[model samples]
Structure formats: C-alpha cells, structure tokens
Target: MTEPNLPSGNDTDTNSSAIPGTAAAWERATLERLAMATLIEQRQARRWRNGIRIAWLVFVAAVAWFGWERGAAPADVSKPHTAVIEIKGEIAAGGDASAEQVVSSMRSAFEDSGTQAVVLLINSPGGSPVQAGIINDEIHRLKAKYHKPVYAVVEEMCASAAYYIASGADKIFVDKASIVGSIGVLMDGFGFTGLMDKLGVERRLMTAGENKGFLDPFSPQTEKQRAYAQTMLDQIHQQFIGVVKAGRGNRLKETPETFSGLFWTGQQAVEMGLVDQLGNLDYVAREVVKAEELVDYTRRDNVAERLVKRFGASIGEGSVHALKLAPSLR
Candidate 1:
C-alpha cells in the first residue's frame, strides 16, 4: 500500500515564503537596529568635537584677557594722585620685585604729570643685590630727573635688599613692629660631601678651569677658594656700605652694629635713624603726598607672563645649575 502523500521539501519552502509580511518584518527590524547604532556613534563623535572646540575657545579668551591686562596702564592720570609701586617678595632677576619691573613702574609714575610723588610699598625679606642695586640707581636717577619725592612704606618685614631699596627713598615709613634691616650680603649652599660619603657615592665633575668647580658642594673646598670668596664678599660689603652711606647721608646714625647684618624692630630702626617715621600707606597718601587719591603702578605678572615663566622653567629643568657669584640678601 502507498503511504499518504507527505509535503515535499520544495512544497514546505513555498508555504513558508507564502507569509510575505513575516519576512519583510524581520528585515525591517535589522535595518532599524543598524540605523540606531549608527546614529548613536555619530552623536558621541560630535559631542567630543564640540568639547574640544569649546576648550580651545576658552583658552584663547583667557590668553587675550591676560595680555590686555598686562599691557594696559594702571589708570588715567588726568588728576593729581599718589603713584604707588609695590615691592613685595624676593627681589630676584625675574621676580615680582625685579629691577626691571620696579624701574618700569617708577618711570611710569615719574613721567605722569598728575603724579605728585612715587611710593614704594615694600613687604619682603630681600633677594639679589644686583637687582636691588639697579632699582636703587634708577630711583635716584628718576628723582633727579622728575624732581618728585619717592617714599618707602614698609608693611611687614623689609630686611636686607629690601632695606637697600628703601634707603634710596626720600623717607621710609614703617609700622612699629616691622622688621627693618639686614644690611648684609651672603652666598649660602649645602655641602653634600658628608652625605655622599655616607651613601658611598662619588661625584663625577669635569671642568675646563681649575676654579670652575671651586664652590661645588660635592667637592672639598680649598683654603684658597675660601679666602677668595671672603675677599669677594668683603668687596661687595664695602660697596653696600658705600651705597647706604650715600643714600642715608646724615639721616643715618652711624654705628658698628648698623651694618652688621642684624635686623631690628621698626621702633629701633627709627631710633637708629634707619626709618624716617612710624606710619602706614594711608598716612603717607593723605598727609605726606597731600593727595588722598592713590594709583597703583606696580608691574605684576599677568596670566601670560606666568605661563611664559612656567614654560621657560620647564624647558630649563634639565640644564646644569650655574654657580651664583653674586651675593643674595636672604
């Protein structure tokens, strides 16, 4: 007997394809998924691009703002005012109290027709003597040229090189408790020879000249080198003494301890004729300058200056340290 006629493979396929809507629905779902995935990836990429663009714009705006602020003068000089310049921090070569910044501020103040006098608002422990010397010389020159009195107003502590600059002022005003002097120069460094011995490390230093590595802390200092250093310090000390004498004139009460690199209270400074008076900035502006209006002409580092300095420091980090022969007043 013949078995009942079952559906052939071709007949089954035809039956499945007869449902056209089911096949079309499956294809539509796959296409929709692919489209959604593509849209998501595009959105993420766009967000990243926008974020970078916004960051770039912000950076450019900040740079421009800093540039404008640094280049712009303090204020308009249409009326009489007291021009104030601040000397606050270590007086180093590229510091806030650098000679370049101080001199530029002084020039601006002296050149202004509406400025009655220039005031140096000082709050520092002091730094490089060379920087201080430049500022001191410029102060004298500006005073001579403009015939305007320059006063020094000490805030907290004005010692060493700070005092050196203050001495150039026509009058020095200080608070009663202010630290006022440290009239000396010194070169300080750490001797790592003992540490190196303990660590069993040898220093490999090569120099063309015999004295090139004279003050290297890793090496033993010779007697001749010590004497040479002392001689140099003595010369600088004599130069410092001369400048103090010239600046203070008869106002200074000459004594052995005056230039002994000792700091004193403001009251003692006044008694020793180191400080002219016990007063503040307001007192000087209102009473001394006779113009209550105050204008700050201090040259300070703006954003651009700070960025440049940081960049330079980063680039020079791998360089060898130079021997500092110039005396520091810290």
Candidate 2:
C-alpha cells in the first residue's frame, strides 16, 4: 500500500483559493507529525530508563554474589569442621572491635547450619570492662545453646579484658611466645596538685556531693576516696578470678602467683594452667576442629561506610599532625 501524503500549507489551488480538502489534509498531517514527535520522545526516555535499570540490576547481582560467596563458602572441609572468627583490636563499646562484633561473629559462626565448631582468634591486650563482660557472657550462652566446642586461640597478646573473653571458651590455645593473662583492672590518670600549687592555679571544681569528685586527677586524693576506689577494683578483681577459675576448671592452680596481674609467655601460661594447649590458630583448626578451610561471616564495609571512614580518618590524622607541628613555647 502507498503511504499517505497530505497537501502542504503552501499548496493552494490557482482556480479556487478555498480548498477544504487540502486544508483538512494539512491539519491532519500537522497533528500526526506532532503526535509522532511526542511518541518518539516517550520511547527514547523509556529505553534510556530501561538501560539504566538493567545496568544497576547487574551491578547489584554481581556484588551480592561476591558477598554471598564469601559468607557461604564451606566453613571447614574436615570431618569435625569449624568456623573461625577473629577478634583483633580494642574491646571498647561502639568501636569496630566491640563486644557487639564479637557476639555477632560468634552468633554467625555457631548459628550457621554448616558450622560444627567455633573458634575465636583473639589478639588484643584488652579494653573496657563492661564490653569484655558482655562478650564473655555472650560466648557462654552461645556455647551452651549450640552444644558446639568454642575455642580461643591467642595470637600475640590476650590480656585483661581479652583474658576475660578467653575465659568463656571451652578450651584456650596460645602460641609459644604469645602474651597471656593480666587478670586485673586498672584506671590511670594524672595528679597535678603540686604543679597547680606552684603555678598559682585553682581546680575550681564544685560538686553536689563530696565523693562525686573522688577521681579528679588535678586534686589530691583523700584517704576515704582512695579506699573507695581500691574497694571497687577489688570487687572487679575478684570477679575476674571467678571467671578464670570457671573456664580453667580443676586444671587451674590456685595461688597468689596465678592472679598476680602479670603477663607471661604462652609456654609459662600452659604450665600455670591458664591455657590448655600451646599452638597457633592453624594447629587448633586442623588438630582440634580438623577443619582445613576458613569462612568469615563478619560483614564487610559497605561503599558509603568505607568512604566515610576513609575521609574521616584522613581528616583526623591531618588535624593531629597539625597540632603536633604547632610551636610549643616553655
């Protein structure tokens, strides 16, 4: 069939100036062209949107698959397979190495249908007492509930709060030279009363209660305040002793030297019954759990979080550097 071609606006008849058919044809063609242009724009927009949507979906699927693989890989390939989770920083609340991370990692390791055992690789000197206690309790709960062996393998240093956490494990392992055991609580601050006196400076601290300013470092500590602080420390110390005893069971040697707030090599620790075995992470993974592979369930940083952390850390470093470089006159 031949395509329709309407008369143009300039195609007026020479004999009759008024040609109704030609005018109608021009009007129809004009309307059709306008409609065609509108349709083309809509179609182009739909194509562009569809292309963008497809590209985004592909990107998401790729990222999701990568993450799933990381989390889904066989935790262990051996008959008594196990999952290993690492805790290698300060154990303060809200930080990246808090009790929250430890609990979440442990939960993931044990709750997984594939994980036959759970191992914690700890390499920390320790942090906040409250955070440590929370992690310890979480470990105990998970261990009892899942009926899976939970082991603590100390790498470099596991002291104080780290030791608190280790005491929850079914068995603890340490390297030959790894630092172990600082079963003590500590709080340190400065006392500048003499300096303030010599410099004619006043603390000017006003408190509602007399004991409220007990820990003010700039002022002299009264005997009453000192006694109170020591009592608090004693209570926490006793609690630490109890946890250590529970974890070590009848193997622990009860003596003043054991809880002397000192750290020793892993070899010394094994003799003192602080750790069950003297070995590194791999030794326990193969010999105890009999697992030849490791699958980490800890969530990786998202793009936004990574960018924010990177920029924030850079800015903080620059600020610290600037402060350090500033002139300090005596």
Candidate 3:
C-alpha cells in the first residue's frame, strides 16, 4: 500500500531534538526567575539594614537634644530659696563632683539675688586634693564677692577631700551616725616584687627618669623613695591641716588624733567641732538658711556628655586615672 504515510527518520529525529530543546529553554527561564528573586530579596534586606541604622541615629540625636535643653533651662529666681550644690561621689577632674561643676554651680548660686544662702550637699568618701582645693578656694571667693553664707549639709559620709571642702563652709550639719573626717593624704600601692620573685616573673619597665618608675608597683621601692613619698604626704597633710584650722578657727577642738587619719561618727565629730550639729537638709534649709524652698544647682553630666564618655571619648582617660598609683586625699 505505499508503506502508508509512515514517518521518515528525519521527522522522528527532528521531533526528539525539539523535545530536548524545549526542556533546555525551560531550565534557562526557571534559572533566570530564581536569580531575579534572589536579587530582589537582597535589595530588600539592604534597605532594611539602612533604615535601622537611620532610626538609631535619630534616637541618639533626640536624646542629645533633650539633654541640652534640660541643662540650658534657666532657674526660677523669683523667690527666696536655698541654693543647693551637690558634691557626691569621688571629687576628681571630669567627675560629677569635679571642681568645674561645683565652681560653676557655686557661681550661679552666689550670683542669684533670690538665693538666700548657698548649701553644699556633701556625701563622698573623698578623692583628689587638687579638686577639693579648687572648690574650697571658690567657696571663699564666692562668699566674699556675694556676701552669701555657704553651709555644708553632710549625708552618709564626708571624709578626706569631702571634709576638706566642708572646712570652707560656715557650718557643717550631719546625721548622728554619719562617718566623718579622714583628713589625710595617702598614696596606696602594692609592691609585687616579692610575689614576682616567688613566681619567677620578671618585670621589664622602661623610663626616662629614675623617679618616673619609682611609683611602679611591679618594681622594688627603695628607702629613699619611701622617704620622699612620706615627705610629700607630710607636706600635703600640712596643707590640709592649715585649711581645716583656718576654716574651723576656734570652733575646732584640737586633739592629737584629729589629723592622724582617724575617722569618727557624726556625734563624735560634733563634740570635736568637726561638725556643727546633728541635722539634715531640710533642717538646714528651713532653720539655718531661713528659706524653706530649696533649689538644686548641681551641674551634672548631661546625657550627651555621658554618652560621649560612655562610648570612647574619655574611656582611655578614665583607664589612666584608674591605673594611677599616685597620691590621693582619701
């Protein structure tokens, strides 16, 4: 019959090739779609990351602005009030109770006509003598300039440098149980030479001057160095004694153990003239100052400043201060 209309070999081969070609084209299209999807997802993720970063920056900026405005707001000076300046914690440079902060607050209080009197709200274990001296000097200067009396209201403990600052006040009020008076200078450190010898650990320290490394804790301390340090302590102690004597005048009851780095309870302090009386902030403001309304003028670190210090701005400086084996008023 004409072998019928049987398919030729060429037709069969063409049809099979067409089927394979179609599969290959399908795979390419599928791969292209997958790639496009991946690109879109990556783009979305990048946008989200950017958005989060921006939000964080905005939040930080808002906090900074609010802190600034709060600090910059002017104090209400319409009525008579007792202007209070806080001296809490360690008194050191770049600290909350630093000379800069205390002095600035003092100046503000003294300059304000509405301020009936200035009160130093002190509660510290003491710190740098230099900072304390600055605040003390400013207390005298501000009192002389404005003819305003400055009183000290002690809470908890006020010793060493805190006592030094309080010495400049007209009167010091304290709680009956408050610990007061460690009126001395000390340079405390541990000599690791013996420990290192036991452990066979050698310390290699380089310095340009012999005295530069004298305070090095890992090295040995010589007799001469010890004497030198003691002499320094004596000199600083004399200065502290002089300040206390001048400030306390006839009010202070002199005793052998008064400046011997000894501490006493607030009751004992009052008996010894180290404290004026047993009282509190409210008592001082109402009775002593004759102004019941109290106004705080303490200059503390704002949020932006604290953030800067918290980040990395003053971290190295703080570490250096911590690592120092130098003299202190405590």
The prediction achieving the highest TM-score against the true structure is 3
Model 3 lDDT tens row, 228-278: 999999999999999999999999999999999999999999999998999
**Candidate 1 lDDT, tens digit per residue, 135-234?**
9999999999999999999999999999889989999999999998899989888789989999999999777778888788999898999999999998
lDDT of 2 by residue, 103-158 (tens): 77778777777777788888998988889889889988987898898889999999
Best by lDDT: 3
Q: How are the candidates ranked when ordered by TM-score, highest leading?
A: 3, 1, 2
- How high is the lDDT of residue 18 in model 3? 97
- Which runs of model 3 end up more than 4 angstroms from their true locations? 1-56, 70-75, 314-330
| lDDT of the structure predicted as candidate 1 | 0.89
How accurate locally, in lDDT, is each candidate? Answer: 0.89, 0.81, 0.90
TM-score of each candidate?
0.77, 0.70, 0.79
Candidates 1 and 3 compared: the better one by lDDT is 3
RMSD after Cα superposition, model 2: 16.1
Where in model 1 is the C-alpha error above 4 Å?
A: 1-58, 71-75, 311-330
